[model samples]
Target: MKLPYAEIEFDDTGERVHPGQVKDAASVISREKATDVIVICHGWNNTAAQARDLYTRVVESMHMVQGEVPGAASRRMVVIGVLWPSIQWADDVDSGAGAGVADEQETLQDMIRARIDDASVADRLVELVPRLEASSTAQEQFVALLRKTLPASTEGEDEAAFEMLATGDVGEVLSAAKGGTDAPDALAAAGGAAGIDPMGVAPLDDGGGAGFFDSIMGAGRNLLNLTTYYTMKERAGAVGRNGVAKALEALHDAAPDARLHLVGHSFGGRAVTAAALATSAKVSSLSLLQAAYSHFGMADDWDGTGKDGAFEKVPSRIDGPIIVTFTRNDKAVGVAYPIASRLARQIGAGLGDQQDPYGGIGRNGALKTAASLPAGTLLDVGGAYAFEAGRVSSLNGDAFISGHSDITGRQVAYAVLTAVATGRS
Candidate 1:
């Protein structure tokens, strides 16, 4: 994700990557042109180093799998890291004005603004990018930019910047600045669908399920959904699951074979599922990690085994499969059932440990809606964060990877990719 050496801009204080900066990164990603684009949305309260570590771990595994190693094939996934300035609140940090969190953020922002102040610094940054794979480099630059701009950006400002980047405007700006807008601009110009509202705040009940996010994780669930909606609309402006539906007619014309692969953690898994269904079956695969499929109603009803009325209509939409990953020890699911109970007012169903009649849960403890997926189709993961732990959340509670936030766990990434690529029941 590193921008072209000539495309990056810098200043005396720091180098700031506005919307235009992402085009270079996107070009790098699109150049890889993998069948499955593993879109990663980091959990809340993650440090720059933490995000890097997590990203590398998965990427390395992907590379290994590509080499016929025990890991997943990175080539199969076009890595897209959604870098938003949404603060992942760690309970350990004080939230008051002048706390260490605020101070550190301010410091980070200063470092960036300062780095961009030097003359030729922007030009020199061009060295950071080459005509090659750069997801890691781009992310580091993005992290640096985040640190530098955190102070200047509000929640909305940060989100707007991310929207710009995701929708291809950032790359357009950068490509135009570089005096060459062929690749970046062309990619940016690719039209797509838009309009997808995030699942607003709702109470979460820790009902001791197998695949939902626990209450302890930070607010990553809603943050992802909100950002996702805005990005989709900005990118395509057509064809979404709900709220907004503006399809990217140009996408159909540009990358005819290209399809979307969505992997959601915890409740975000639920969001991914709903979002995917909204598409015209253009999605290749869906991986739900410990997600809570709340469309059926509330917590009490989850264990009741009642039929998921509206949800039942989803599986038939896309030709792809659905994979749900969860674990018996995960406390995240414990939180989801109660939440479903309170809201839907119906008794929840089972923890999905044994079997959810729906379909698609891997032996790794994931729930699957499709036993076998299309050749290019991905799995739809549901329940809580089945394989991992508390990592991301929203205003109500934590969700992404219901069990734990350490997506870098030994077999977690393996299990996820294996289930998706293989589509084993």
Candidate 2:
């Protein structure tokens, strides 16, 4: 099917794979005389087909529910989808040997070799994978190599990432990666519960022979998952700040009078937020769906040490309301963020929930922003929203958002359309 939207592709280094594609998209928006442009970005672990499907479904949903908002159905808006080189977080470890013995090892090896910048570190890490569960020395070596492989943390929230990597006990690293068992309901919602399970790895302990994550290989898989989490985080930031930001500017240059609305899911959320901060164009609104960023990511002073979030200036740059959809049902961010929190030494129950210092924006909502961000529910289709310009609204999506990828529903589309319309004069 011929998609309704144009696409901008980016490489791993944040360079445009096809620069003319962006320029062409810009020309179309200008030629079409669009009044508003909505740029949607997909998060990590998506294939090219998956990314296209995401854009297709989301745009379809928006079109299906545009009438819910006043003037939305008649709005002159153009859609642009972003495609970056984002890999799966735990594809290697998720299937384990059950996926295939030689194939599993080869896949893990290929992933490690591709992601880790240092050849020596990647080789050593891959060699140690086989012994991670049985040998303490192998586990220790794996952790040390990973510590060396990852770039040094520069943010206040990431201060403990290296510390977690530097641990001598592989079990502690695994436990940290496990992110504790504080919220059983979230796990159930993830597919272990009574409803949808988008993550597919939610029910780790279903009492079925120690489950997959409890096995010896599963222990090793935990460390691999942690490594990819950090790797993808860095890659997403690069693609957004350097690639998407430039695209937004190009779109603005081509159509200076058009209003720009940014929408991103998971790591794409981090990317678009970074783009908003870097671009000179005036952004009308931002819709972050289950964003895989820190809850403290936009705070001016989350630590009280005078340090701010990585994207602390984002809210100031957005001209309209910053709409964030979050829920405890998202196991992707729920599991990963708590590992980061545990690295920061914020252990115990509720590690990835709203109160944790290192909780994810997707798992909770916009937290510790400079302004007092209001909290509300992610209303149903045709529901009313009292969104104010230049403020942040955290929408509780536990009722509607069943998983991380549940952003393409009519209800979510309505909320996004409402956000775009709120920016209209």
lDDT of 2 by residue, 312-381 (tens): 8888899998899998877777655545554545643455676667688998798878653678999998
Model 2 ranges with Cα > 4 A deviation: 1-4, 90-130, 166-175, 178-216
Identify the leading candidate in terms of lDDT.
Answer: 2
List clashing residue pairs in candidate 2.
Answer: 188-193
lDDT of each: 0.32, 0.73
TM-score of each: 0.42, 0.84
Write down the TM-score for model 2.
0.84
Best candidate, TM-score-wise? 2
Span of ten consecutive residues with least summed lDDT in model 2: 190-199
